[model samples]
Target: MSVLYALAGLLIIAAVVSLVLSLLGVIVVGALRILPVVFVVLAAVFFLSGGRIDVHLPDKWRRK
Candidate 1:
């Protein structure tokens, strides 16, 4: 009887941890998927401003 109670307690704890980790994983994956879209929108905005805005790359990043 005591062993069964212990096992149940452990199962509950494991389930809670798994649920939290799954939620975090979902949030991180969503952010990563949306990042490119965010950048594209910003770039479009800059271009629509009629060359008033410019994006500069670092010296090492500049194409030869």
Candidate 2:
């Protein structure tokens, strides 16, 4: 009947919406989990390069 068709259509639409939301949620969570790792890597690099936060200039930029 017409009511059955409407219900089926609604169900399909809901399923699609749920799928999209779940995918986005997964992507966001994955990025959040990696954020700490990225920060740790940055800290390691900074410490390895010495305590100074200044940038090293290239030969062309340095005055004689």
Candidate 3:
């Protein structure tokens, strides 16, 4: 009976971990999907602001 209880606890732990991981994966994917749109909007705002917005992006994101 003790071993069975231990196994049940392990199963519950595994299920919880899996649920958390899946939620994280979903959030990451959702952010990635919206990233391009975010960038576009930022770019628009930057240009409209005449470089006053200060996006502070990486150098690679800048055009030569």
Best by lDDT: 2
Of candidates 3 and 1, the better by TM-score: 3
Model 1 lDDT per residue over 1-64, tens place: 9999999999999999999999999999999999999999998987888757468889999888
* Model 2 TM-score on a 0 to 1 scale: 0.61
Off by over 4 Å in 3: 52-64
Candidate 1 residue 49 C-alpha distance from true site, Å: 7.2
Q: What is the lDDT of residue 27 in candidate 2?
A: 100
What's the lDDT for candidate 1?
Answer: 0.94
| Superposed Cα deviation of residue 56, candidate 2 (Å) | 23
Q: Which segments of candidate 2 are over 4 A away from where they belong?
A: 42-64
Q: Estimated TM-score per prediction? A: 0.60, 0.61, 0.78
Clashes of each: 0, 0, 0
Superpose all Cα atoms of candidate 2 onto the true structure and report the RMSD in Å to 1 decimal. 5.3
Worst 10 residues of 2 by lDDT: 49-58
Candidate numbers sorted by lDDT from highest down:
2, 3, 1
- Encode model 3's per-residue lDDT on 1-64: one tens digit a residue: 9999999999999999999999999999999999999999999998888885455789998899
Report the lDDT of model 3 for residue 49: 85
